[model samples]
Target: MVRTAVVNRVQDLWVSLAGVGTGFPTGGVRVVVAPESRLCPPCWAGIVVLGDSGIATAPDAATAGFLRESLTGRPLRSAVEAERWSGERGVVDVLGPASLAYLDESEFRPATSDAGIARLPTGHPALARLVADVSEDDVGESGIDEITSAVFVVRDGAGVAAAAGYRRWPRSVAHLCVLTSARLRGRGLARAVASAAVADALRSQLLPQWRARPEPSRRLARQLGFRELGDQVSIRIAAHQVDSNGDRGQPGGRRP
Candidate 1:
């Protein structure tokens, strides 16, 4: 089980992302309009379910009212059950049921570094080659290019075999992003690089969060001493629903 402190910190992060300025719920789900919310795309509605505490958000008043009226008082899981609640054009795409885990400094188990593993800039040539080596879909899933922190990588020949980093998100959330080339799968490189990145985040006093949709990625996070506290899901409002209002991957990962 995760510590109470861990869950509270994660819940607090989502509360900030929800942009509602309301206290985290004690039970059931709460809905609010947070057009400025970063939990999901600018215009799209989203949800973050933490145990029994759930927060759902929409970009504007009308859609927000629809969701607030339809979803509040429902089970916390309803936050992710867009098909049942979003009646307009229905759900567009659901991001998860992704594992949301966080690292505690005391529990962190750093991976052993290899001679070839080193820190790299996000724009390094090896990273570019690694991106080209992987499928476009996988590249997008990994979010390799979007990280705001220094990248850790293991090299194969001259190109990267695996890489890891995190986005410095709001509330000091270090949202981890990791990728391992298919050819280098099962080589422990993902763990090596992810370990370095997580350690760096910890040294900076950032809360390192690993959100993984893929079981392999989830396992890697667990191996690194990140306790699974809850789960995450982001929802997209359908077109017709958006007409009334205005608004806004599993990246390839190897087993730890």
Candidate 2:
């Protein structure tokens, strides 16, 4: 009994450390507090952040309802979440299975960049179309523009099937996102686009951050020289109780 209670306490502490709350949808896409939107983190699967908080599964109606009730009017002051790494604070060395293994310059090879650049055209319809087809939880028009350094529409001389983009961040951090059409299933377009984006980020001195979905995708990332940063975990709770500094305990808690 004592061990169980202790374990629960520890788990609760972990939850508190990760600044978690519900994401509310606004303007089509669910708008949760994402610190790295500028970097255009992947929006297809779980949402990721560069700061203390990690990636979170976007809240749906059921999830949102739970958050609204739990947090109420309280404010979440901290940014915390489960980190995939076990370190005090450091760069994520994602160079193993489940990541792109190519060196920085290797990413910029002609073959990779070629497809990524072509997919996203000027004022192309791919953006809106992708959002419409993918999920009702799109970030809307702004999301279309926000997710790309430049958009490319991938085609095989027929019609547009997939769209790709590159996003960058300070301190050598970068990422890629590809929106594929429903008709084109089991195609390798996403991987090609990802390679291009990684190449671009490497050329510009931005470290690549890859967020792959499902086991196969994760395996691809690993093969491509990108390692999983770690599983970003989140939980909902009363916002007022969250701590900003990595410190948690009773209010007016003594300084360590």
Candidate 3:
């Protein structure tokens, strides 16, 4: 279980992202017009339900009003739910509904030995080769290329069998990411490299965050002693449904 302090730290991070300092009501949702909010993805809007406190962002006050109207009664499970009540302006290109988790050092189950794990600089040639070895979808899911921290890896004769690292997000969050070769997955390469990465993040005094949509990834995070905190989803809403050129309009294709 995550400690109370650790829990609050995560809460504070979301609150900051939402740009709601003291206005975030207790046990209630705060709908704000913050197009520039770090919380807002490239989509029209996004909402994060963190325990009793929740925040929703919109591009303008009118849009904020719509979000407030739908999100008034209680916290939503995800932005997908927001689509149901959006009327004609339906959501498109929904990003997540992913699980957000955090780690506490006291409960961290670091690997017993780091014998095979090696530390490498960001954007190393071996890392590039490993990225090339994996499927495009796998690389996108892992977000391995965005890593700004030291990468931990387990190597095989071909190249890096598995690699793990973190992207430094806002509020000192070390967003953990792990990727493994399809052929070498059955081995414990992911666990070993990820453990090394998590250890490094904790040592740097950054909060380790794990966001996963896949059960296996969630299981790996749980195995490493990360606590499931909340769910986050981003939805792009349709603006006018079509453009002046009489062309089809995708909701998430262009910012509404």
| Candidates sorted by lDDT, best first | 3, 1, 2
Q: Which is superior by TM-score, 2 or 3?
A: 3
Model 2: per-residue Cα lDDT over 175-228, one tens digit each: 555556666746776566656656666667665555543465565566566544
Report the lDDT of model 3 for residue 75.
38
**Model 1: per-residue Cα lDDT at residue 5:** 73
> Which runs of model 1 end up more than 4 angstroms from their true locations?
1-3, 72-74, 81-89, 241-256
The lowest-lDDT stretch of 10 consecutive residues in candidate 2 is 247-256
Residue-wise C-alpha lDDT for candidate 1, range 64-159, written one tens digit per residue: 665665575566676665455444344666666667789989999998655677888878887877888889878877788999899999887888
Question: How high is the CA lDDT of each candidate model?
Answer: 0.75, 0.40, 0.76
Clash counts per candidate, in order, are 2, 28, 0
**What TM-score quantifies how close candidate 2 is to the native fold?**
0.46
Q: By TM-score, highest first, what's the ranking?
A: 3, 1, 2
Residue-level error in angstroms, candidate 2, position 228: 1.8
Model 3: per-residue lDDT, tens digit, 21-116? Answer: 534456566777765666656546777766655677766655565566556664355333535534434445566667889998999998778998
Task: Score residue 133 of candidate 2 by CA lDDT.
Answer: 59
